[model samples]
Target: MTSTLTAPVQPETVHAIEVGVMQDRIIPEPVGPPSYRASYVTRDTAPGKARRGVVLALKTWGLEQLADTAELLVSELVTNTFVHTDSRTVGVVVTRTAETTVRIMVLDTDRAEMSVPTCPSGDEESGRGLFLVAALADRWDIERVSTGKRIWCELDTKKVQP
Candidate 1:
């Protein structure tokens, strides 16, 4: 995707945002590669389980700074698997790829259309999942895999000296 910034579109232009990061977050990224993976039978409880798994991974890797956002993204992605697709299982992987970047991938056995981000109205509650994903993740995408499709996202944090 290519975007050309003109005079009308300036980075400093700001208005009231419904939701956003309240303050600067520093990741304190780890020194080496660390990762965690889990596969679950998709059910109503899958989202909660996935959130726990992500929290554990973030904690184990000493990236607790990312726990809140990471877990929420994982829950959203995992919930979409069982709720929108016929797949019985969902696979989640959390990998720390760099000193300041972590990637999350949710795989499911469905080749359905990739999830789309949307602007939901104030009164609507159901359509905001993907929107939240797009809003919070530094980068996110979906692609076709052999078994199905994978929706992934990355969350980057700044390194802070202690």
Candidate 2:
């Protein structure tokens, strides 16, 4: 596993930053409060920094644990886009519910059905991205968009601070 460090900000300070970020950033209008979004394009290169930034942003919401899990989720999602879908444009959004649950959604161009991450044989080299996401995320699912598809996984921090 890759490693990245996020400067720890106090919960109150992080909460404030989250509010400011949401206020300054453009957000889609949903039924309830608009969710925060972060988008990136995948490539043959790894998506480590992008994943780290995402984890930091969510840290402001006191979802540090969720953010940690999200790093893996986002990495897998972005990596999958590069591996499975030929498209490089990948978008990720972090949506929170009134119940204080956060969902990470990754959008990629290939609407032609997707596959779940299954455990590879012990000696095998790979095929465990989705498996990690499945284990870390509370729940996950996929949806078809007008252009491509969006794969989402929900993480429940269980702490409703923000």
Candidate 3:
């Protein structure tokens, strides 16, 4: 009698683990300027904590003018993660993609719960998070992964013209 041998199981590798809106898209190192990134574990106070970190990073990158809007956007994303997902942790990343643009991404671990952003009626108190994100952000998109999804938005950091 003869027996067949089985191969060992290999752990899954996260090929593209950085923050961005594109699934499976590898983020190369910033070629022109330095970028800012931070990750935080999910908690009751995660939104505030993430906001503070983002504010600091934006200031450090000399994008202070975008602080208020960015802070609000980041807070909304973080809140969505904790309020909607069963994720244990969340990743926050802020990157200056161009002289006048900055990208922010929030990653969480709840693949099955992902949904497109929706707008709530004016009288409604909730469901307006993503609506605000789309309004304020120059562009926004979502990316799904093996573990979960990432919601990302890009802002034009340049001063607006009247």
Find the candidate with the highest TM-score and give its number.
3
Superposed Cα deviation of residue 51, candidate 1 (Å): 0.9
Return the clash pairs for model 3, or none: none
Task: List CA RMSD, all candidates.
Answer: 19.0, 12.3, 11.4
What candidate 2 gets wrong by more than 4 Å, as runs, is: 1-34, 44-46, 116-118, 159-162
- Model 3: residue 82 alpha-carbon error in angstroms: 0.4
**Residue 52 shift from truth in candidate 3, angstroms:** 0.9
For model 2, what is the alpha-carbon lDDT of residue 149?
91
lDDT of 1 by residue, 14-84 (tens): 22222233211112223446877666777787788778778987887788888999988999999889889
**Which candidate number maximizes lDDT?**
1
- Residue pair clashes in candidate 1: none
Q: What tens digits encode model 3's per-residue C-alpha lDDT throughout 1-162?
A: 999998986534313333243222212234555555555667667788778777877787777888899999999999988988888778787888887889999999887756666667789889988888989999998889887998999988776431
Q: Candidate 2, residue 91: CA error in Å?
A: 0.5
- What TM-score fits each model? 0.74, 0.70, 0.75
Candidate 1: clashing residue pairs, number: 0
Tell me the spans in candidate 1 whose CA falls farther than 4 Å from its real position: 1-32, 159-162
